[model samples]
Target: MRLIQIINDIRLKRKLSLIFITVAVLPLLISGIYLTNKLREVMVSNAFEQASDNVERVQKRTAEVINVALDISYQLSNDNRMKSIASRSYDSYNEVIQTYRQYTDIRDYVRLYKEIKAIRLYASNPTMLNNWEFMQPDEQTTKEAWYVSALNKKGLAGWGYIQDERDQKHYLSLVRKINLDDLKNESVLVINVNSDLLNSILSQESFATMIVDDSNNIVAANRPDLYGKNLSAVHAESNMLWQSEGSFDAVMNGKNSKVVIANLNPQNSWNGLRIISIFTISDIVHDANAVIRISAFVVGGCLVIAVLLVYASASLITGRLLRLSKHMSQVGTLSWDSYLDLDGKDEIGQLSRQFNALVHRISQLMFEVEESNQQKQLLLQKQNDIKFKMLASQVNPHFLFNTLESIRMEAHLRGEEDLAQAVWQLSILIRNSLEVGSRQIPLSEELNMVRCYLELHKFRFEDRLQYKMEIDPATEGIEIPPLIIQPLVENSILHGLDRKEDPTLITVRTRLNDHGELFVEIQDDGAGIPPKKMKDLTMRLMDSEEPGNRIGLRNVNDRLQLTYGQGARLSIESEEGRGTCITFCIPKKGVEPVVFSDNR
Candidate 1:
């Protein structure tokens, strides 16, 4: 009752107090949420944009720098400097090698060769580029991917990696091809790039950036260590089987994260992928406590100051309020020292006016608070709207139902009209039961439709199947939600029936309370759900996966909880032969369009 009175009082004064309280409190709350979400998105977008721009810039710069090196290598490949060695002449090859060593080490030209590790030109098509090392005869092998692609590709290009004499890694290889028709074209002009530099081209600065292949496998990560791991894995629950696109909020190491991914084959190249995701932490757990503390401080401080004014300046209150009003004319620009402009002897009057002004400010804040609360409520409603739609679309039972209806219609025109119409009605009922797109549906509609489906199936098998439905008369007018009962009936039919020769019996019951809620119970007799399968199904429902999980029931459960807060749930109770029963406890609100006609 005290809480109710407080709420009533706030509502009464809501308009007056908005400016002072709600203006400050509500922005802080909303801004707190925006900071947690929007800021991370901004940071990630900026980071990737910078990364792509940097890579392009580096590639352009490298192209310019490497032109000189490629020209020199091309000139030498045909010149007497390299061709002398190509003819297996010791003196010529030795002179060329000495000339190479005098200038700089092998690492010097790597920054120029964007994709070559260590390249040596061959006089004729020698089997391997590595075999013609200048000084130290290292791990020179002709069988590398870069070596093969270089000789074959014949352009300004870079392949992946290969280790050198020092067993150091390198990622680029470049080879220039010659016309060879004019002069006795000796060797292929080759200039290999250093691999370490290639890796450094896109290293991590803050959050990691990774490149995924078509298979969802990470080909490269800014961290380098995660280069081969797959990001789509959830304890092997989801694998990167196909290309996926969108932004989703996920949990990473128990921290809230928003991940956005796009299949990027920029320049329309299918050779690689661009996969980007950003993570941000959210702790409303802490925000709630902060709000409580801040609210206490705000309300307590204002009340304390108000009490002080009443006790300290009773007689001069009206004059003080006027003086304060004059001072506030320059809210942001005024000087506090000149606040007491009154020439009267009533110092107490001046103080009283100022105190009253303070009270007025609090009143304005209260009004603003109400406005802010309304805005928050609106925002929540919008978010729930999307959530409801997502849940409804999750498990689409439309296709199966539509096919059933088609079968029924064909049967109806062929002299089995009663049975066909029954099938048609059952299909329509199932279709109606599949919609989870709303938070609240009318209880009347929910019950009537379930009755249609249950009756249809009940009549199909004649005396072989039986059903009992009970509803509390008082709960008839209450509002509930759509499609909350079908899953319970389904579980009973599929699991409880269990192919038993004994007749099948199912029961559905509903009850309600003054607090505005509905309780629905469904009981069936057949083979009961085992404790193990039941537990697994419950767990899977929380995190639905396709094919092996309870796709229908889990999807329904998710929709129920997400749409109607925590009040709705599905409960199952069954044992072998003395059949099974499932119950859906739903709220007495939001039920509507009680029955969907097959007309659509």
Candidate 2:
């Protein structure tokens, strides 16, 4: 009740503003917040579900690779030829090589299956020659962990990273004890699984995925650098892999990461492998953040519109009341038909007189303001014209001297026809330069001038200087200040030729950035600016004073800043003895469409 009484005491404008905010803004604000949060939750849930599916897919593929090794092991375990070769003792190396060649099943399996890289049988026969395929185990080989573990497992298969005697490169191999004549640790079959094939399976996965054995040695991984590395060596939060079958959040490689693990238990294997897939949280919900940003922008835009509408409505209501009050106070104050009206210096009468004086003063001010704006416009036009002329004067003398010297040198060396062509091109450049006074031309026309300049230089430099223009077709219709591109191109050629004997390449490229801003770059693969000079030049470009050395460059920078605000200024990137790239960007807001044109 007190709130209602207080509200009633306020003016009608305040009441309307409050009502507008309550009715239009409050509900929208509430719904927008609720929708944003729900959308984020749904996105996160969907990402989790998708990641789970990916893990399952990787598990199936990884199982197939593991099954190949198991199938080969099963087939070889029952083969009589392999059993006989391991059981028999060989007296001579020649006899052993002949016997190995005759028993081709192991070689055939390695050759037939893309999943199998190598197959070796370790026999305990003392007289057997140590052929690579059938190797006699030494004392150290018999005591190794893999060898001892396979012996203890009695014929059950195991997987591990074992060093191959041939290349000495460690590979994920299936190690199993082959029971020959009731001797458990007498013979064994070691089938090295194709590490390339295992890596290929994980390569198809989107996230960083790897296959780790029960021993925590990474057998194969999508990231090649992690192959054969222990789990603890790569990730600090490796303890999560001990859980071995679920998704968990941890820090991997110094980044917050989500890890999903699944076990691959083959048919009769002693130990199964683990499939671990890791992805950063940001990568999983990038699309969600984008959606949230768009939602916030929309909500903020609507709230701004609502506030504006409320202010406008309040101003309209209060203005009407003030006008009504003025008219009411005027009644009985003005008299007609030769009767003298006496006015009191009361509050209402004083307000009426003051209002009239304000009106007269506003009228006079409006007239003076209009006159001042016209003068400013005229002054701006004159300034632009003078600026263009100054920039042109600074460029022509240096350009003409160089161009004429080139033509004279060419005429001396070549035929008169070449000199005529050079002269015609020079005439065209002069005309274009003279006509470019404060007028914006299509980007295509400016690029055409740059091409002409490069062509003339090509005639002078021959193969010493080469240039290419990678111009975006969309930017062709954009209207930009004339002579902006050609001067920069000339600057590149001038510096690019100095202290360089190799073929110099001048690349003039133009494109639009993601924000629809126009970007232009002039690149030169030649001797670059030294760091000290580069620093001095950068500082000089920032000063308001005009530069004496790089006048054309400074002029172009000034004109771009003046026409399109300070965001459009030249940026220099250079490394001494390597190359230099000069780039500039014009903001999207600064690129205005021009309806009128004077070609001259």
Candidate 3:
């Protein structure tokens, strides 16, 4: 409570300042920092995705090159002629030259395919001459690890960096043992894949990329300086590189970097290669940080402008309110002569003008108080006289009801039962017409009054007039305006039976319609109104003009519209010489409430 009082007591200017700081400044700063961090993350993520795609492309191209070499190796391994040439014992150098010239497939492969650098077959047959395509392995060549491994594998192919004996240059080569059919000696086939092809593929990439064999030797690289170097010498996570196959964060070139790795497993080869792409995270988000700096400057400028605007607006408002407050204090002294004189087109100026009008009104009211008191006494005396007259007017209805009762008793005493019954019914109709005027009555009570009215008519018309009621028991207690149905019943007898000698039947039905609304209908099988008269009656019922005479239909329509709105008005359907039906449905909501009463 004390804190609330303190806050309430603060000046408006200071309150606005606090709101600006908490609502605008703090949230702006927090959101700016959050967005900056999110943008940096998005930049890094996009960089990694591009690098991953680069690695995939390099792996695919590298696989294509390596697959070419493997296919060539398999074809040459199964070549019966090459196997025969390598395994057969040659007696002379001319025979060896002629044989090498005849088998021109190896030379055609290295010449026709850009991916194959060289193809060489090392034979252990001493009689075979050391031609460029077919070489006789010496002691040093047979002792090489690749040669020994290929020999130990018996028939499977192996891939590794092996130097061509002719050029003494190292290349990524596929080494396979080709077993002679009937001989114990095995010949080795080497297919050197062009390292330049792999290097060109990586050079076209944006990030630094390289293909490394399982031995950790960089076979090909976009960076020439890193070629042929072990991965451990250049990367810190070299030991763990083989452990992860996809991507990971690491330190490279003394900077934070993301590295993506993809594997290239060639067909029918013992060793597979890994394609690696590395890019620094800082390089990826460098542009994003510059954009954030400019955005921060713009946001700060806006906040400064907002602070100035808020302060200036607060000062202007508080100054006007303080001046108004001082003048309001003088109003306690009842000084109406001096009014507020503030000026402007704003709301405060309008308030000042209204205050002046109020002061003038107060002064005028003071002068009129005595004159109003003098008139009040005269109105009281007149009201008392009117009340006496209204009381006198109610006495006649009671006297008439008493006189009807006396007549009914006299008829009963004289043994005139029919006359007594007629008198009783007449009394009911007269009492309701006089006392229940324009008030709501229960449908059951209204029906009883209607019965009385109809019975009296029956006494006059005899068999010529007949009436029937089809009232749903559930609608007996529903309230409706008095005389709504009785007037229509009376109209039927007057218009139908009076003009014609034929009999007429009137039906009063009360039931719920499909929408659960109360539907009341009075239908008569008598001579209906003509078309012209019917049109005039409908127009008059809908019009707001005061009906000069025969206001029963118009009055009922007005009451229905006034009580239940326009949708509850009556519908009349009549045809000349046939019948007429007058129906009005009260929405179930309107019938549920007892909305009108005559307390008089």
Q: Please, what are the lDDT tens digits per residue for candidate 1 over residues 1-600?
A: 664333323422342354335444554565456454544554545544554444444444344434445555545544553444344434455555555565343445544445444555544433223334432222344454444554565443332323444444332333444434334442344454443443454463234445454545554556656654665662122422343655555556666555545554322122334455444444212323444555566556656655564444333344445656666664435233333443333434445456557656766787899999999999999999999999978755767876787788788779887788788777767666566565565666677787787778777667767888787876665555456676667778777665666788888887865655667778877667777876766776667563444437776776778767676766656554466666666665533224435892
**Most TM-score-accurate candidate:** 2
Query: Which parts of model 3 have CA positions greater than 4 angstroms off?
Result: 1-39, 238-241, 282-600
Question: Candidate 2, 141: how far from true, in Å?
Answer: 1.8
lDDT score at residue 367, model 3, on the 0-100 scale:
75
**lDDT of model 1, residue 431:** 64
**Each prediction's Cα lDDT score?**
0.54, 0.78, 0.82
Better of 1 and 3 by lDDT: 3
Who is ahead in TM-score, 1 or 3?
3
Shift in Å, residue 447, candidate 1: 99
lDDT string, candidate 2, 380-402, tens digits: 99999999999877856657757
Task: Score every model by TM-score.
Answer: 0.29, 0.44, 0.43
Q: Rank the candidates by TM-score, best first.
A: 2, 3, 1
> Model 3 clash pairs?
none
Candidate 3: lDDT over CA atoms?
Answer: 0.82
Off by over 4 Å in 2: 1-40, 182-185, 253-255, 286-600
